[model samples]
Target: MAPPQPKAVAKPAAAPAGGVQKAKLGKPRNYDLGNGVVRFSKTKMFHKKAKYKFVGKKNPKAEKAKKPTVVVKQIGGEKNGGTRTVLLRRRRSFYPTQDKITPRPHHKTFSKHVRRIRPNLTPGTVCILLAGRHAGKRVVLVGVLPSGLLLVTGPFVFNSCPLRRVPQRYVIGTSTSVDLGDFQLPAHLDDGYFKKNKKSAKRTVKRKTGEDIFATKKEKYVPSEQRKADQKLVDEAVIKAIGKRADKKTLRGYLKAAFGLRSSQFPHRLRF
Candidate 1:
């Protein structure tokens, strides 16, 4: 095979002789001229708060006409409608107790309703942030908690919970209404940590067994009392084979004595 061909390099894009064109420049920059300070610029200054009166078409048809007041003639019907002649007169009444009056408490539960919100919250459900610095402010529910915590935004959630109770309302899935100016945050995520983590993950080696995952050693099987006794006998036989001074008959007698087993009469003197 011939020598491997070198990869072709990309040429840098050259600008025109006049230099690179710039993007559309927005309104001119503003300078806050403090006491004994003045700022001058070669470019024209633009007024941000400059009011412009829009002189456009004023459609006569679009103007709303005021409805004429209906003056009802007093044909004896005015007495029934008028509230001026109303009088408060007690007919018959008694003190109403719990038995006489049905007490209705305004108890509302947010089990299935109060949910986690993200991006933004819905407009309808009222919200009083149970946590964070914006805790007191009631806001309209603007988002759903697909995974965690409730989300509320706007002013309504504040008004609904006068006592600073649970946020409630209808779920209105609408467009996001996040005021960028009110609360500012980074426009994009920083992925330097993410890239480093990915490289570390690639170089990582997995455990051969589940036991390696834990710091402490796994528990081994322990024989019961009965099983231990049987194993002891087997161990004694093995030890005896290796020239140990182990006697099976003597071992049984020793076990019986250690276990407090006793006979009322001597075994040699006992009759059948």
Candidate 2:
């Protein structure tokens, strides 16, 4: 501007010997080579090296392995019948005495605080069925099965209940009972025997005549002759036993009294 000073010429910055530009002091830029290779800046390279170096080390204390105590107990049937020994490993003591080394203290038994009175379901006892198809029906207890099931019958003449095995929980026993001395049953009498007889009785009788004379005639099957006679005797005995407590006015009245049912809870009105 002052007397036409010589026009200053700007010269381009020259690259370094390695053909790469030196980064500024405060700012750095990354260089990209072909094939996904990137030359990181100096700060980035320092941070990457420091990330993989294991500077801080920790030594954890080793844990001790605990050994479990073994216990043996006798289980199953009698001495020589079906008994066997069982081995049990106990990681922790379950018994109160074993957990705490304390002297044996006398405490009130469970019966003192809470009394659990189970129904007396002996043989020849009169009980009311509480569940199943025979529910609300009065049946006489015949005997007990080996598996603790109760064998009962409705004598077919009364509630039409046949000989059946029922769970003890399904029947509510009463104080009335008959003399079971003459009503002894077989030790292995089960539902299978009655089912077999029932199936046999249902077999169709073949007519010898070739004529279809009675094509529409259907005959009813009788399961057991001797068992029917015995059932009648048991029915008589049960009626006599229940006579003391029940009113013999009518069959329904007798059943209602025997089962201790109220007017609202009558067996005929209640649905299963």
Candidate 3:
């Protein structure tokens, strides 16, 4: 090897007039204290004045927040018999207009939009439990995500199920009323059995005299007294149905139709 070459030494950063090296100089800048951390003396102590005021005299209201407006509701029957009235909230305006302004009428009807009630179900509607354990179970439909179809099911009834399992008959009907009407007894029994037959259909009467009775003799005969009794009952029922207590204004045409009544004959019956 030739004569050993001397390595160049690095120059130290310059110290400012304040006798402190500026942090802008790139280096592992540190200070030496005997054992504890070196406490750098600050040239200026920065402080801020509080913006909050305790006592305001001239504009005391400005310091306090504005009180919120409230509307109270009145509940009870109105002048029109049983008519109901409610107080709607009035919108506040920052500035008054030249003409006395009133709020526009709201015409929102529920029929316009179909509401989504369940998570696993689609946006339009859900199935109602008409009967059974899982009958009324509804699933929620989550917003469509790219990964897969998002179905929110159950928590209780929102639980997910295969779409193929949904039944067409289980859908909700638009009709307000499901008129099942009257329930009829089974056809196996005679009409007389339904009529106040205190005896059981399977039970047979045994005579203590050891005499056998034919079906014809066993059958009860309809006497004139029975006919008269039945007619009286029918007349009373008809009268009570069309009585004043069954006020036409508060009831539908049930009573009127039962008594073979027409709208022209009883105009008051059609008021409701």
Q: Would you list the C-alpha lDDT of every candidate in the order shown?
A: 0.37, 0.65, 0.36
| lDDT over C-alpha atoms for residue 57 of model 3 | 34
Q: Cα lDDT of model 1 overall?
A: 0.37
In candidate 1, what are the lDDT values of residues 1-272, reduced to their tens digit? 89999999998667678897556667534554778544653333323333233346455767689654443344347547543432244335744455665688955655445454433353333333434444444343323343233334332221322111232332222331222222221222122211222222123333786544434433444545643453344333322332322453542232122111166865345321
- Residue 52 shift from truth in candidate 1, angstroms: 99
Among all windows of ten consecutive residues in candidate 2, which has the lowest summed lDDT? 196-205
Ranking by TM-score: 2, 1, 3
Writing each residue's lDDT as its tens digit, candidate 3 over 71-157 gives 444556666344344435455654555878789997766544444433333432223333334444443221222222222212231
Q: Which stretches of candidate 1 lie over 4 Å from their true place?
A: 1-123, 155-272
Candidate 1: worst-modelled 10 consecutive residues by lDDT: 156-165
RMSD of each: 38.0, 24.5, 29.7
Please give me the total number of clashing residue pairs in predicted model 2: 0
Best by TM-score: 2
In model 2, the clashing pairs are none
Which candidate model has the greater lDDT, 1 or 3? 1
- Model 2 TM-score, all chains together: 0.37
